[model samples]
Target: MRVGIADTTFSRVNMGAIAVDELRKHASVAIERVTVPGIKDLPVACKKLIEERRCDIVMALGMPGGKDKDKICAHEASTGLIQCQLMTNTHIIEVFVHEDEAKDDRELAWLMEQRTREHAVNAVKLVLHPKDLERQAGTGQRQGFEDAGPARR
Candidate 1:
Protein backbone atom coordinates (compact mmCIF):
# COMPACT_ATOMS: atom_id res chain seq x y z
CA MET A 1 0.00 0.00 0.00
CA ARG A 2 1.08 3.56 -0.67
CA VAL A 3 0.53 6.26 1.95
CA GLY A 4 0.67 9.88 0.86
CA ILE A 5 1.77 12.59 3.28
CA ALA A 6 0.70 16.19 2.65
CA ASP A 7 2.06 18.82 5.03
CA THR A 8 1.98 22.60 5.30
CA THR A 9 5.16 24.68 5.19
CA PHE A 10 3.60 27.59 7.09
CA SER A 11 4.73 26.30 10.48
CA ARG A 12 8.15 25.46 11.81
CA VAL A 13 7.14 22.11 13.21
CA ASN A 14 7.98 18.99 11.25
CA MET A 15 5.00 16.90 12.17
CA GLY A 16 4.66 15.33 8.74
CA ALA A 17 8.18 13.98 8.78
CA ILE A 18 7.69 12.59 12.25
CA ALA A 19 4.48 10.94 11.09
CA VAL A 20 6.20 9.32 8.14
CA ASP A 21 8.95 8.01 10.37
CA GLU A 22 6.48 6.51 12.82
CA LEU A 23 4.49 4.97 9.99
CA ARG A 24 7.61 3.31 8.67
CA LYS A 25 8.17 1.71 12.04
CA HIS A 26 4.66 0.26 12.18
CA ALA A 27 3.86 -0.61 8.57
CA SER A 28 5.82 -1.48 5.50
CA VAL A 29 4.30 0.82 2.86
CA ALA A 30 5.50 3.12 0.15
CA ILE A 31 5.36 6.83 0.99
CA GLU A 32 4.67 9.82 -1.21
CA ARG A 33 5.32 13.20 0.39
CA VAL A 34 4.26 16.70 -0.66
CA THR A 35 4.68 19.99 1.15
CA VAL A 36 2.36 22.90 0.47
CA PRO A 37 2.50 26.57 1.43
CA GLY A 38 -0.24 26.47 3.97
CA ILE A 39 -3.19 24.53 5.33
CA LYS A 40 -5.45 25.59 2.47
CA ASP A 41 -3.15 23.90 -0.01
CA LEU A 42 -3.27 20.53 1.71
CA PRO A 43 -6.45 19.40 -0.01
CA VAL A 44 -5.12 19.92 -3.51
CA ALA A 45 -1.83 18.26 -2.63
CA CYS A 46 -3.66 15.29 -1.22
CA LYS A 47 -5.88 15.04 -4.27
CA LYS A 48 -2.90 15.01 -6.54
CA LEU A 49 -1.17 12.40 -4.42
CA ILE A 50 -4.17 10.15 -4.63
CA GLU A 51 -5.22 10.68 -8.26
CA GLU A 52 -1.76 10.98 -9.74
CA ARG A 53 0.51 9.14 -7.34
CA ARG A 54 -1.91 6.26 -6.75
CA CYS A 55 -1.76 6.47 -2.96
CA ASP A 56 -4.21 4.32 -1.04
CA ILE A 57 -4.47 6.87 1.77
CA VAL A 58 -3.41 10.47 2.34
CA MET A 59 -2.39 11.99 5.65
CA ALA A 60 -2.96 15.75 5.78
CA LEU A 61 -0.89 17.51 8.48
CA GLY A 62 -0.90 21.18 9.39
CA MET A 63 -0.67 23.53 12.34
CA PRO A 64 -3.06 26.43 12.22
CA GLY A 65 -2.15 29.79 13.69
CA GLY A 66 -3.67 31.15 16.85
CA LYS A 67 -6.22 33.49 15.40
CA ASP A 68 -9.85 33.53 14.36
CA LYS A 69 -8.92 33.93 10.71
CA ASP A 70 -6.56 31.00 10.99
CA LYS A 71 -9.28 28.85 12.48
CA ILE A 72 -11.60 29.82 9.65
CA CYS A 73 -8.98 28.87 7.12
CA ALA A 74 -8.49 25.55 8.82
CA HIS A 75 -12.20 24.89 8.59
CA GLU A 76 -12.19 25.67 4.89
CA ALA A 77 -9.21 23.42 4.35
CA SER A 78 -10.93 20.62 6.25
CA THR A 79 -14.04 20.96 4.10
CA GLY A 80 -11.98 20.81 0.95
CA LEU A 81 -10.19 17.73 2.23
CA ILE A 82 -13.52 16.00 2.80
CA GLN A 83 -14.55 16.79 -0.74
CA CYS A 84 -11.32 15.38 -2.05
CA GLN A 85 -11.87 12.19 -0.12
CA LEU A 86 -15.33 11.74 -1.58
CA MET A 87 -14.16 12.49 -5.10
CA THR A 88 -11.37 9.94 -4.93
CA ASN A 89 -13.10 7.40 -2.72
CA THR A 90 -10.01 7.31 -0.53
CA HIS A 91 -9.34 8.09 3.10
CA ILE A 92 -7.75 11.49 3.89
CA ILE A 93 -6.69 11.44 7.51
CA GLU A 94 -6.59 15.02 8.77
CA VAL A 95 -4.14 15.75 11.60
CA PHE A 96 -4.45 19.42 12.53
CA VAL A 97 -2.86 21.09 15.53
CA HIS A 98 -4.04 24.62 16.19
CA GLU A 99 -1.59 26.99 17.83
CA ASP A 100 -4.14 27.74 20.54
CA GLU A 101 -5.02 24.17 21.43
CA ALA A 102 -2.30 23.96 24.02
CA LYS A 103 -1.34 26.29 26.82
CA ASP A 104 2.21 26.91 25.61
CA ASP A 105 4.55 26.34 22.75
CA ARG A 106 6.18 23.35 24.37
CA GLU A 107 2.85 21.66 24.98
CA LEU A 108 1.64 22.43 21.49
CA ALA A 109 4.79 21.01 20.00
CA TRP A 110 4.38 17.84 21.99
CA LEU A 111 0.78 17.51 20.92
CA MET A 112 1.68 18.00 17.30
CA GLU A 113 4.28 15.28 17.41
CA GLN A 114 2.01 12.88 19.21
CA ARG A 115 -1.01 13.52 17.05
CA THR A 116 0.90 13.27 13.80
CA ARG A 117 2.50 9.96 14.72
CA GLU A 118 -0.76 8.49 15.92
CA HIS A 119 -2.61 9.54 12.79
CA ALA A 120 0.05 7.92 10.66
CA VAL A 121 -0.54 4.66 12.45
CA ASN A 122 -4.24 5.16 11.96
CA ALA A 123 -3.73 5.60 8.21
CA VAL A 124 -1.90 2.30 8.10
CA LYS A 125 -4.66 0.58 10.04
CA LEU A 126 -7.31 2.06 7.79
CA VAL A 127 -5.62 0.46 4.84
CA LEU A 128 -4.44 -2.86 6.27
CA HIS A 129 -6.18 -3.68 9.54
CA PRO A 130 -9.37 -1.70 9.88
CA LYS A 131 -10.81 -4.36 12.11
CA ASP A 132 -8.37 -3.42 14.83
CA LEU A 133 -9.73 0.09 15.00
CA GLU A 134 -13.30 -1.14 14.78
CA ARG A 135 -12.74 -3.25 17.85
CA GLN A 136 -11.45 -0.21 19.76
CA ALA A 137 -14.44 1.92 18.92
CA GLY A 138 -16.15 3.50 21.98
CA THR A 139 -13.13 2.64 24.07
CA GLY A 140 -12.38 6.38 24.27
CA GLN A 141 -8.91 6.16 22.92
CA ARG A 142 -7.69 9.63 22.04
CA GLN A 143 -4.82 9.24 19.60
CA GLY A 144 -2.47 11.75 21.21
CA PHE A 145 -3.65 11.63 24.80
CA GLU A 146 -4.74 9.22 27.43
CA ASP A 147 -8.20 7.70 27.13
CA ALA A 148 -10.96 9.30 29.14
CA GLY A 149 -13.43 6.67 30.11
CA PRO A 150 -17.17 7.20 30.32
CA ALA A 151 -18.32 9.14 33.37
CA ARG A 152 -20.55 7.46 35.90
CA ARG A 153 -22.80 9.23 38.30
Candidate 2:
Protein backbone atom coordinates (compact mmCIF):
# COMPACT_ATOMS: atom_id res chain seq x y z
CA MET A 1 0.00 0.00 0.00
CA ARG A 2 1.06 3.56 -0.60
CA VAL A 3 0.34 6.62 1.57
CA GLY A 4 0.46 10.17 0.30
CA ILE A 5 1.62 13.00 2.57
CA ALA A 6 0.67 16.57 1.65
CA ASP A 7 1.97 19.47 3.76
CA THR A 8 1.97 23.26 3.58
CA THR A 9 4.97 25.58 3.73
CA PHE A 10 3.19 28.51 5.32
CA SER A 11 4.07 27.39 8.83
CA ARG A 12 7.54 26.67 10.15
CA VAL A 13 6.67 23.34 11.71
CA ASN A 14 7.79 20.12 10.07
CA MET A 15 4.59 18.19 10.62
CA GLY A 16 4.85 16.31 7.36
CA ALA A 17 8.25 14.92 8.16
CA ILE A 18 7.14 13.85 11.61
CA ALA A 19 4.11 12.14 10.14
CA VAL A 20 6.22 10.33 7.56
CA ASP A 21 8.50 9.02 10.27
CA GLU A 22 5.56 7.90 12.38
CA LEU A 23 3.92 6.12 9.48
CA ARG A 24 7.17 4.37 8.64
CA LYS A 25 7.38 3.11 12.21
CA HIS A 26 3.80 1.86 12.31
CA ALA A 27 3.17 0.46 8.84
CA SER A 28 5.11 -1.00 5.95
CA VAL A 29 3.74 1.27 3.22
CA ALA A 30 5.31 3.43 0.57
CA ILE A 31 5.00 7.21 0.96
CA GLU A 32 4.52 9.95 -1.62
CA ARG A 33 5.07 13.48 -0.36
CA VAL A 34 3.86 16.83 -1.76
CA THR A 35 4.56 20.21 -0.23
CA VAL A 36 2.39 23.13 -1.22
CA PRO A 37 2.56 26.82 -0.41
CA GLY A 38 -0.34 26.98 2.01
CA ILE A 39 -3.50 25.36 3.30
CA LYS A 40 -5.46 26.52 0.26
CA ASP A 41 -3.31 24.25 -1.90
CA LEU A 42 -3.85 21.07 0.11
CA PRO A 43 -6.88 19.89 -1.84
CA VAL A 44 -5.17 19.97 -5.20
CA ALA A 45 -2.06 18.36 -3.79
CA CYS A 46 -4.08 15.57 -2.24
CA LYS A 47 -6.03 15.06 -5.48
CA LYS A 48 -2.87 14.80 -7.50
CA LEU A 49 -1.40 12.31 -5.08
CA ILE A 50 -4.48 10.16 -5.36
CA GLU A 51 -5.19 10.52 -9.10
CA GLU A 52 -1.69 10.64 -10.48
CA ARG A 53 0.48 9.10 -7.79
CA ARG A 54 -2.13 6.41 -7.13
CA CYS A 55 -1.77 6.51 -3.40
CA ASP A 56 -4.13 4.38 -1.35
CA ILE A 57 -4.60 7.16 1.21
CA VAL A 58 -3.56 10.78 1.61
CA MET A 59 -2.64 12.75 4.74
CA ALA A 60 -3.00 16.50 4.38
CA LEU A 61 -1.15 18.42 7.11
CA GLY A 62 -1.15 22.16 7.68
CA MET A 63 -1.01 24.84 10.36
CA PRO A 64 -3.46 27.66 9.98
CA GLY A 65 -2.60 30.95 11.59
CA GLY A 66 -4.50 32.41 14.50
CA LYS A 67 -6.85 34.79 12.75
CA ASP A 68 -10.36 34.94 11.38
CA LYS A 69 -9.09 35.02 7.83
CA ASP A 70 -6.93 32.01 8.50
CA LYS A 71 -9.86 30.10 9.91
CA ILE A 72 -11.99 30.94 6.88
CA CYS A 73 -9.29 29.74 4.52
CA ALA A 74 -8.92 26.54 6.49
CA HIS A 75 -12.65 25.95 6.22
CA GLU A 76 -12.61 26.43 2.49
CA ALA A 77 -9.66 24.09 2.12
CA SER A 78 -11.40 21.48 4.24
CA THR A 79 -14.50 21.65 2.04
CA GLY A 80 -12.41 21.18 -1.05
CA LEU A 81 -10.64 18.22 0.53
CA ILE A 82 -13.99 16.56 1.26
CA GLN A 83 -15.01 17.01 -2.34
CA CYS A 84 -11.74 15.53 -3.53
CA GLN A 85 -12.32 12.47 -1.41
CA LEU A 86 -15.73 11.99 -2.95
CA MET A 87 -14.44 12.47 -6.47
CA THR A 88 -11.53 10.08 -6.07
CA ASN A 89 -13.33 7.61 -3.81
CA THR A 90 -10.36 7.64 -1.49
CA HIS A 91 -9.56 8.79 2.03
CA ILE A 92 -7.76 12.09 2.57
CA ILE A 93 -7.13 12.47 6.27
CA GLU A 94 -6.82 16.15 7.18
CA VAL A 95 -4.51 16.94 10.09
CA PHE A 96 -4.71 20.65 10.77
CA VAL A 97 -3.17 22.48 13.74
CA HIS A 98 -4.45 25.99 14.32
CA GLU A 99 -2.08 28.42 15.96
CA ASP A 100 -4.76 29.49 18.46
CA GLU A 101 -5.41 25.95 19.70
CA ALA A 102 -2.59 26.14 22.17
CA LYS A 103 -1.44 28.70 24.72
CA ASP A 104 1.93 29.59 23.22
CA ASP A 105 4.27 28.83 20.35
CA ARG A 106 5.93 26.06 22.28
CA GLU A 107 2.59 24.44 23.12
CA LEU A 108 1.34 24.82 19.58
CA ALA A 109 4.41 23.13 18.20
CA TRP A 110 3.99 20.25 20.61
CA LEU A 111 0.35 19.82 19.64
CA MET A 112 1.20 19.88 15.96
CA GLU A 113 3.75 17.13 16.36
CA GLN A 114 1.42 15.00 18.43
CA ARG A 115 -1.58 15.47 16.13
CA THR A 116 0.41 14.78 13.00
CA ARG A 117 1.89 11.56 14.33
CA GLU A 118 -1.46 10.30 15.59
CA HIS A 119 -3.12 10.99 12.28
CA ALA A 120 -0.34 9.16 10.48
CA VAL A 121 -1.12 6.06 12.47
CA ASN A 122 -4.79 6.60 11.74
CA ALA A 123 -4.07 6.71 8.01
CA VAL A 124 -2.19 3.45 8.19
CA LYS A 125 -5.02 1.84 10.09
CA LEU A 126 -7.47 3.02 7.48
CA VAL A 127 -5.53 1.25 4.77
CA LEU A 128 -4.32 -1.88 6.52
CA HIS A 129 -6.56 -2.51 9.53
CA PRO A 130 -9.83 -0.62 9.27
CA LYS A 131 -11.46 -2.80 11.87
CA ASP A 132 -9.21 -1.28 14.51
CA LEU A 133 -10.85 2.08 13.95
CA GLU A 134 -14.32 0.58 13.90
CA ARG A 135 -13.76 -0.99 17.27
CA GLN A 136 -13.57 2.48 18.82
CA ALA A 137 -16.97 3.50 17.49
CA GLY A 138 -19.34 4.99 20.08
CA THR A 139 -16.51 5.47 22.50
CA GLY A 140 -16.64 9.26 22.19
CA GLN A 141 -13.02 9.54 21.25
CA ARG A 142 -12.44 12.48 18.95
CA GLN A 143 -9.27 12.80 16.95
CA GLY A 144 -6.71 15.45 18.04
CA PHE A 145 -8.52 15.95 21.33
CA GLU A 146 -9.07 14.28 24.62
CA ASP A 147 -11.68 11.52 24.68
CA ALA A 148 -15.10 12.56 25.93
CA GLY A 149 -16.92 9.78 27.64
CA PRO A 150 -19.93 9.76 29.92
CA ALA A 151 -19.46 12.10 32.89
CA ARG A 152 -19.71 10.55 36.26
CA ARG A 153 -22.32 12.17 38.44
Candidate 3:
Protein backbone atom coordinates (compact mmCIF):
# COMPACT_ATOMS: atom_id res chain seq x y z
CA MET A 1 0.00 0.00 0.00
CA ARG A 2 1.13 3.57 -0.71
CA VAL A 3 0.08 7.09 0.20
CA GLY A 4 0.80 10.38 -1.57
CA ILE A 5 1.31 13.81 -0.11
CA ALA A 6 1.15 16.91 -2.29
CA ASP A 7 2.17 20.02 -0.39
CA THR A 8 2.94 23.65 -1.22
CA THR A 9 6.13 25.60 -0.62
CA PHE A 10 4.44 28.93 -0.10
CA SER A 11 3.09 27.85 3.26
CA ARG A 12 4.73 29.20 6.37
CA VAL A 13 4.47 25.87 8.16
CA ASN A 14 6.15 22.73 6.86
CA MET A 15 2.91 20.85 6.50
CA GLY A 16 4.50 18.17 4.38
CA ALA A 17 6.99 17.33 7.07
CA ILE A 18 4.28 17.19 9.68
CA ALA A 19 2.24 14.90 7.48
CA VAL A 20 5.19 12.65 6.81
CA ASP A 21 5.89 12.21 10.48
CA GLU A 22 2.26 11.60 11.29
CA LEU A 23 1.77 9.09 8.50
CA ARG A 24 4.91 7.19 9.31
CA LYS A 25 3.85 6.90 12.90
CA HIS A 26 0.43 5.48 12.04
CA ALA A 27 0.90 3.31 8.95
CA SER A 28 3.50 1.04 7.41
CA VAL A 29 2.73 2.04 3.83
CA ALA A 30 5.09 3.61 1.34
CA ILE A 31 4.84 7.38 1.15
CA GLU A 32 5.25 9.57 -1.93
CA ARG A 33 5.74 13.31 -1.62
CA VAL A 34 5.44 16.12 -4.15
CA THR A 35 6.30 19.64 -3.14
CA VAL A 36 4.76 22.27 -5.39
CA PRO A 37 5.24 26.01 -5.52
CA GLY A 38 1.74 27.06 -4.51
CA ILE A 39 -1.75 25.79 -3.76
CA LYS A 40 -2.72 25.94 -7.44
CA ASP A 41 0.00 23.48 -8.35
CA LEU A 42 -1.12 20.73 -5.98
CA PRO A 43 -3.61 19.10 -8.36
CA VAL A 44 -1.03 18.14 -10.98
CA ALA A 45 1.39 17.06 -8.34
CA CYS A 46 -1.26 14.90 -6.65
CA LYS A 47 -2.21 13.36 -10.01
CA LYS A 48 1.39 12.57 -10.69
CA LEU A 49 1.75 10.93 -7.33
CA ILE A 50 -1.37 8.88 -7.90
CA GLU A 51 -0.86 7.92 -11.55
CA GLU A 52 2.91 7.98 -11.94
CA ARG A 53 3.99 7.14 -8.42
CA ARG A 54 1.12 4.73 -7.95
CA CYS A 55 -0.05 5.94 -4.59
CA ASP A 56 -3.34 4.42 -3.52
CA ILE A 57 -4.41 7.54 -1.71
CA VAL A 58 -3.30 11.19 -1.57
CA MET A 59 -3.39 14.22 0.68
CA ALA A 60 -3.26 17.75 -0.69
CA LEU A 61 -1.87 20.09 2.01
CA GLY A 62 -1.81 23.83 1.50
CA MET A 63 -1.90 27.07 3.51
CA PRO A 64 -3.38 29.93 1.59
CA GLY A 65 -2.63 33.44 2.72
CA GLY A 66 -5.20 35.72 4.30
CA LYS A 67 -5.74 37.90 1.29
CA ASP A 68 -8.59 38.38 -1.14
CA LYS A 69 -6.59 37.14 -4.09
CA ASP A 70 -5.20 34.30 -2.07
CA LYS A 71 -8.68 33.14 -1.14
CA ILE A 72 -9.75 33.24 -4.77
CA CYS A 73 -6.74 31.25 -5.86
CA ALA A 74 -7.34 28.71 -3.12
CA HIS A 75 -10.91 28.15 -4.30
CA GLU A 76 -9.73 27.74 -7.86
CA ALA A 77 -7.10 25.29 -6.74
CA SER A 78 -9.69 23.31 -4.77
CA THR A 79 -11.87 23.05 -7.86
CA GLY A 80 -8.93 21.80 -9.85
CA LEU A 81 -8.22 19.22 -7.18
CA ILE A 82 -11.79 17.97 -7.41
CA GLN A 83 -11.39 17.66 -11.16
CA CYS A 84 -8.16 15.78 -10.73
CA GLN A 85 -9.82 13.37 -8.33
CA LEU A 86 -12.64 12.72 -10.81
CA MET A 87 -10.23 12.25 -13.70
CA THR A 88 -7.86 9.96 -11.83
CA ASN A 89 -10.53 8.11 -9.89
CA THR A 90 -8.55 8.67 -6.72
CA HIS A 91 -9.31 10.21 -3.37
CA ILE A 92 -7.51 13.44 -2.47
CA ILE A 93 -8.02 14.53 1.10
CA GLU A 94 -7.65 18.27 0.89
CA VAL A 95 -6.15 19.79 4.07
CA PHE A 96 -6.21 23.51 3.47
CA VAL A 97 -5.36 25.90 6.33
CA HIS A 98 -6.12 29.45 5.39
CA GLU A 99 -3.98 32.02 7.13
CA ASP A 100 -7.11 33.79 8.19
CA GLU A 101 -8.07 30.83 10.29
CA ALA A 102 -6.14 32.29 13.17
CA LYS A 103 -4.77 35.71 13.91
CA ASP A 104 -2.05 34.47 16.25
CA ASP A 105 0.95 32.71 14.79
CA ARG A 106 0.92 30.09 17.51
CA GLU A 107 -2.71 29.20 16.85
CA LEU A 108 -2.09 29.01 13.14
CA ALA A 109 0.80 26.65 13.64
CA TRP A 110 -1.25 24.47 15.94
CA LEU A 111 -4.12 24.40 13.48
CA MET A 112 -1.81 23.46 10.64
CA GLU A 113 -0.34 20.54 12.52
CA GLN A 114 -3.68 19.36 13.83
CA ARG A 115 -5.30 19.49 10.43
CA THR A 116 -2.44 17.89 8.54
CA ARG A 117 -1.94 15.06 10.98
CA GLU A 118 -5.65 14.32 11.19
CA HIS A 119 -5.98 14.09 7.45
CA ALA A 120 -2.93 11.85 7.23
CA VAL A 121 -4.64 9.38 9.52
CA ASN A 122 -7.73 9.56 7.36
CA ALA A 123 -5.69 8.81 4.25
CA VAL A 124 -4.25 5.76 5.94
CA LYS A 125 -7.66 4.50 6.93
CA LEU A 126 -9.03 5.01 3.44
CA VAL A 127 -6.53 2.66 1.82
CA LEU A 128 -5.76 0.30 4.66
CA HIS A 129 -8.90 -0.17 6.77
CA PRO A 130 -11.95 1.61 5.50
CA LYS A 131 -14.10 -0.16 8.07
CA ASP A 132 -12.57 2.15 10.65
CA LEU A 133 -14.34 4.98 8.90
CA GLU A 134 -17.67 3.19 9.03
CA ARG A 135 -17.24 2.88 12.75
CA GLN A 136 -16.87 6.62 13.02
CA ALA A 137 -19.71 7.42 10.69
CA GLY A 138 -21.91 10.33 11.90
CA THR A 139 -19.66 10.71 14.90
CA GLY A 140 -18.91 14.31 14.07
CA GLN A 141 -15.28 13.51 13.48
CA ARG A 142 -13.35 16.61 12.45
CA GLN A 143 -9.79 17.64 11.83
CA GLY A 144 -7.83 20.72 13.03
CA PHE A 145 -9.95 21.25 16.12
CA GLU A 146 -12.15 19.62 18.64
CA ASP A 147 -14.70 17.30 17.08
CA ALA A 148 -18.30 18.24 17.44
CA GLY A 149 -18.87 14.81 19.00
CA PRO A 150 -21.79 13.52 16.90
CA ALA A 151 -24.62 15.85 16.18
CA ARG A 152 -27.33 15.69 18.85
CA ARG A 153 -26.91 11.93 19.11
Candidate 4:
Protein backbone atom coordinates (compact mmCIF):
# COMPACT_ATOMS: atom_id res chain seq x y z
CA MET A 1 0.00 0.00 0.00
CA ARG A 2 1.33 3.37 -0.93
CA VAL A 3 0.45 5.77 1.88
CA GLY A 4 1.17 9.43 2.06
CA ILE A 5 1.65 10.75 5.59
CA ALA A 6 1.26 14.50 6.02
CA ASP A 7 2.40 16.79 8.82
CA THR A 8 3.00 20.51 9.04
CA THR A 9 6.49 20.05 10.41
CA PHE A 10 9.38 17.68 10.01
CA SER A 11 8.60 16.13 13.36
CA ARG A 12 5.41 14.64 11.92
CA VAL A 13 7.34 13.57 8.87
CA ASN A 14 9.66 11.79 11.26
CA MET A 15 6.74 9.97 12.82
CA GLY A 16 5.52 9.09 9.33
CA ALA A 17 8.94 7.61 8.78
CA ILE A 18 8.46 5.40 11.81
CA ALA A 19 4.95 4.36 10.75
CA VAL A 20 6.22 3.51 7.30
CA ASP A 21 8.95 1.37 8.78
CA GLU A 22 6.43 -0.50 10.88
CA LEU A 23 3.96 -0.97 8.03
CA ARG A 24 6.74 -2.37 5.86
CA LYS A 25 7.01 -5.31 8.24
CA HIS A 26 3.43 -6.39 7.53
CA ALA A 27 2.58 -5.11 4.04
CA SER A 28 3.90 -3.29 1.04
CA VAL A 29 3.92 0.39 2.05
CA ALA A 30 5.53 3.54 0.79
CA ILE A 31 5.43 7.00 2.39
CA GLU A 32 5.96 10.59 1.39
CA ARG A 33 6.20 13.49 3.86
CA VAL A 34 5.05 17.05 3.21
CA THR A 35 5.79 20.23 5.16
CA VAL A 36 3.90 23.51 4.98
CA PRO A 37 4.54 26.88 6.55
CA GLY A 38 1.87 28.02 9.02
CA ILE A 39 -0.96 26.76 11.18
CA LYS A 40 -3.10 25.92 8.16
CA ASP A 41 -0.15 24.31 6.39
CA LEU A 42 -1.37 20.74 6.56
CA PRO A 43 -4.25 20.84 4.05
CA VAL A 44 -2.16 21.85 1.09
CA ALA A 45 0.61 19.53 2.07
CA CYS A 46 -1.93 16.74 2.35
CA LYS A 47 -3.26 17.48 -1.14
CA LYS A 48 0.20 17.57 -2.62
CA LEU A 49 1.18 14.32 -1.01
CA ILE A 50 -1.97 12.61 -2.19
CA GLU A 51 -1.65 13.85 -5.76
CA GLU A 52 2.10 13.71 -6.15
CA ARG A 53 2.73 10.52 -4.21
CA ARG A 54 -0.52 8.84 -5.29
CA CYS A 55 -0.99 7.43 -1.83
CA ASP A 56 -3.68 4.95 -1.02
CA ILE A 57 -4.39 6.72 2.24
CA VAL A 58 -3.68 9.95 4.01
CA MET A 59 -3.50 10.49 7.75
CA ALA A 60 -3.42 13.77 9.66
CA LEU A 61 -1.39 13.95 12.86
CA GLY A 62 -1.53 16.88 15.19
CA MET A 63 -0.60 17.81 18.75
CA PRO A 64 -3.96 19.37 19.62
CA GLY A 65 -3.23 19.70 23.28
CA GLY A 66 -0.52 22.12 24.27
CA LYS A 67 2.78 21.29 25.97
CA ASP A 68 2.32 23.37 29.10
CA LYS A 69 0.51 22.84 32.37
CA ASP A 70 -1.41 26.06 31.80
CA LYS A 71 -2.35 24.84 28.36
CA ILE A 72 -3.77 21.62 29.74
CA CYS A 73 -5.77 23.57 32.30
CA ALA A 74 -7.54 25.44 29.53
CA HIS A 75 -9.62 22.52 28.34
CA GLU A 76 -12.66 21.17 30.13
CA ALA A 77 -11.03 17.98 31.32
CA SER A 78 -13.47 15.13 31.06
CA THR A 79 -13.46 11.42 30.36
CA GLY A 80 -15.13 11.77 26.96
CA LEU A 81 -13.38 14.81 25.65
CA ILE A 82 -13.69 14.85 21.88
CA GLN A 83 -10.62 16.83 21.22
CA CYS A 84 -8.55 16.62 18.05
CA GLN A 85 -4.94 17.32 18.76
CA LEU A 86 -3.74 19.25 15.79
CA MET A 87 -0.52 17.90 14.34
CA THR A 88 1.94 20.59 15.32
CA ASN A 89 4.77 18.19 14.78
CA THR A 90 2.99 16.11 12.10
CA HIS A 91 -0.36 14.59 11.01
CA ILE A 92 -2.06 12.44 8.29
CA ILE A 93 -5.32 13.75 6.79
CA GLU A 94 -6.87 11.22 4.35
CA VAL A 95 -6.12 8.23 2.22
CA PHE A 96 -6.41 8.98 -1.45
CA VAL A 97 -7.81 6.46 -3.94
CA HIS A 98 -7.88 7.60 -7.51
CA GLU A 99 -11.34 7.28 -9.02
CA ASP A 100 -10.02 4.96 -11.69
CA GLU A 101 -8.20 2.79 -9.18
CA ALA A 102 -10.93 2.64 -6.55
CA LYS A 103 -13.47 1.57 -9.12
CA ASP A 104 -11.32 -1.45 -9.86
CA ASP A 105 -11.60 -2.87 -6.33
CA ARG A 106 -14.17 -1.67 -3.82
CA GLU A 107 -12.65 -3.86 -1.15
CA LEU A 108 -9.41 -1.95 -1.50
CA ALA A 109 -11.19 1.23 -0.40
CA TRP A 110 -12.51 -0.43 2.72
CA LEU A 111 -9.12 -1.87 3.49
CA MET A 112 -7.46 1.47 2.93
CA GLU A 113 -9.91 3.21 5.21
CA GLN A 114 -9.29 0.63 7.89
CA ARG A 115 -5.56 1.00 7.52
CA THR A 116 -5.71 4.78 7.49
CA ARG A 117 -7.78 4.90 10.66
CA GLU A 118 -5.54 2.40 12.34
CA HIS A 119 -2.40 4.21 11.32
CA ALA A 120 -3.66 7.55 12.63
CA VAL A 121 -4.93 6.23 15.95
CA ASN A 122 -2.05 3.90 16.65
CA ALA A 123 0.57 6.40 15.65
CA VAL A 124 -0.90 8.91 18.07
CA LYS A 125 -1.03 6.48 20.97
CA LEU A 126 2.31 4.81 20.37
CA VAL A 127 4.32 7.69 19.00
CA LEU A 128 3.12 10.62 21.11
CA HIS A 129 3.99 10.86 24.79
CA PRO A 130 0.82 10.68 26.87
CA LYS A 131 2.21 12.73 29.70
CA ASP A 132 3.46 15.41 27.38
CA LEU A 133 0.15 15.56 25.52
CA GLU A 134 -1.83 15.63 28.74
CA ARG A 135 0.34 18.28 30.33
CA GLN A 136 0.44 20.28 27.18
CA ALA A 137 -3.32 20.45 26.85
CA GLY A 138 -4.34 19.55 30.39
CA THR A 139 -6.51 16.69 29.23
CA GLY A 140 -5.48 14.69 32.24
CA GLN A 141 -9.03 13.48 32.69
CA ARG A 142 -8.84 11.94 29.26
CA GLN A 143 -5.82 9.81 29.97
CA GLY A 144 -5.17 6.13 29.38
CA PHE A 145 -7.70 5.74 26.59
CA GLU A 146 -7.66 3.68 23.43
CA ASP A 147 -9.46 4.61 20.21
CA ALA A 148 -8.74 1.27 18.53
CA GLY A 149 -10.54 2.21 15.35
CA PRO A 150 -9.43 -0.92 13.55
CA ALA A 151 -7.99 -4.31 14.48
CA ARG A 152 -4.44 -3.52 13.55
CA ARG A 153 -3.90 -3.00 9.85
All models, RMSD in angstroms: 1.2, 1.5, 1.1, 16.9
- Give per-residue CA lDDT, model 4, range 11-93, as digits (tens): 21234444455555545456676644322444655556556676555564322222454234223221111121232233344
Scored by CA lDDT, what does every candidate get? 0.91, 0.91, 0.93, 0.42
Off by over 4 Å in 4: 10-13, 37-39, 65-144, 147-153
lDDT of prediction 4: 0.42
List TM-scores for all candidates, in order. 0.96, 0.95, 0.96, 0.41
- lDDT tens readout by residue for model 1, 36-68: 999999999999999999999999999999999
Model 2 deviation from the true structure expressed as Cα RMSD, one decimal place: 1.5
Best by lDDT: 3
Candidates by lDDT, descending order: 3, 1, 2, 4
**Can you list the residue pairs that collide in candidate 2?**
none
Angstrom error of the Cα, residue 139, model 3: value is 1.4
* Model 3, span 66-135: residue lDDT tens: 9999999999999999999999999999999999999799999999999999999998888888999999
Model 1, runs deviating above 4 Å: 151-153
Better of 2 and 3 by TM-score: 3
